[model samples]
Target: MKVAVVKYNAGNIFSVVHALKRMGVEPLLTDSEVELRSADRVIFPGQGEASNAMNYLRERGLDRVIPSLTQPVLGICIGQQLMCRHSEEGDTDCLGIFDAEVKRFQPVKHEDKIPHMGWNSIQNCQIQNSKSSLFKGLDGEFVYFVHSFYVPVCKETAAVTNYIHPFSAAMQKDNFFATQFHPEKSGEVGQQILRNFLEL
Candidate 1:
């Protein structure tokens, strides 16, 4: 199957590619509309600022092309934030595929770090018997996360993680799936999540 890792002005692109390679799938990293649209599955993974990333996407016309995609699309970290309706990072408007808003984490205590970094356990929030494909067979698993902004618990939330508060660890809406954590760096559990996305 053809998997495209979106190439843009964002960090961690190679890491995602490496993860897929470990899964025995060589993915194409491209900004070309044709290459992206033609792929069987698209992975929009990034580690960067919100507005800068959005600017790059808009400049390349990906902002318009991404939301219209019919195939499965997975957004990671900043990729997930940009997929939301809006973001508090740069007061930016993003691709409204998930109908959610990304907000900066407001630390209320000393331990509540601004950038909630490192590994954290993710709880399956899907209703009884209706589990998310992303979390299939993996429950209460720890995933690596490195971000200061988060999407609050919402209807689209597929998984939740607690740090400063309960926030969206992963989200799913139709063919679009997203995770605020870095699945590429989440070890075995991360590998499973990426494998699940590929199999979808």
Candidate 2:
């Protein structure tokens, strides 16, 4: 399959690339509208400040291109945050691919952390359908997550996880799919998620 990973100023791009290679898919990394549009599937993965990432996407016209993709598109980490309507980080407006908002974590207790790093189990929330689910065969599975910000339990939520509180670990809306966690770094569980995404 012609898998394309969106190229932008974000971390974890190489990790995502390597993960795909492990699955035997040589993914094309590009920011070109034509290349992205022609791909059978596309993945947008990143780790960065929301404002800076939004600025990068806007400059490359990817802000417009990404939202308009007709094929299955997956967003990871900050990529998921960017796909939401707005982000509390830098008080920025985002791509609006999902009708959601990204908010900074407000630590309430002693154990509550700023960046909720490490593995956390996920509960499959209301998935849109079986055909495009990334959580298929996943039951209380632990995936890698490293983020300070989180999207709340929204209509588009496909999976839920708790750290400071319950948050949307994975989300989907039509052809768009996203994960707040880094599935690429989640080991076997991560690989399974990628395999499920590839099948779609």
Candidate 3:
């Protein structure tokens, strides 16, 4: 299968590349709209300022190409945030694949950290009914996460994780799937998630 990892001016691309290699797959990395759209599967990975990232996507016309992709696409971290309707991080408007908005973490208590980094277990939201392709063979597993903003619990949410309050850790809507956490860096369980995505 031809998997294309949409390369934008973002971080965490190498980690994802390595993860795919471990999964016995080597995905083409490109920002070209034609290349992205032609791939069998697409992985939209991002890590950086939202506005700049969206600007880059727009510059290459991939901002439109991405949303129109027919194959399964996975977004991670800032990639996931961009898939939402809007984000508070840069007061940015994003690709509306998921019908949710990204907001900065509002720590209700003094003990809560702002970024909400590290490992956390996911609470299956069961939005996808059967075990989702992304969560196949994994049940309520802990995965590595590092983010300051989060998508509010919404209709597309397939998995939930508690930070200050329960929020979307993973989401699915047709061919689009996303996770706020970095499954590539989450070790074994993370590998399984990536493998599951490859299978899908």
Per-candidate RMSD vs. true structure?
A: 1.2, 1.3, 1.1
Q: Which candidate number would show the highest TM-score if scored against the true structure?
A: 1
Those runs of model 3 whose alpha carbons end farther than 4 Å from true positions after fitting are: none
User: In candidate 2, which residue ranges exceed 4 Å CA deviation?
Assistant: 128-132
Which of candidates 1 and 2 is the stronger one according to TM-score? 1
Whole-model lDDT per candidate:
0.92, 0.92, 0.89
Estimated TM-score per prediction? 0.97, 0.97, 0.97
The alpha-carbon deviation from the true structure for residue 11 of candidate 3, after best TM-score superposition, in angstroms, is 0.9
lDDT of 2 by residue, 1-200 (tens): 89999999998799999999999999999999999999999999989999999999999999999999999999999999999999999999999999998999998998887799999999864575453368777868888899999999988898889888899998999999999999899999999999999997
C-alpha-based local distance difference test score of model 1 = 0.92
lDDT of 3 by residue, 54-150 (tens): 9999998888999999999999999999999998978988998988889999888899998898999988846746666688777688999999999
Model 1, poorest ten-residue lDDT window? Answer: 124-133
lDDT of 1 by residue, 1-200 (tens): 99999999998899999999999899999999999999999999999999999999999999999999989999999999999999998999999998899999998998887789999999974733489998878989999999999999898999999997899999999999999999999999999999888787
Give candidate 2's error at residue 150 in angstroms: 0.4
Candidate 2: the clashing residue pairs are none
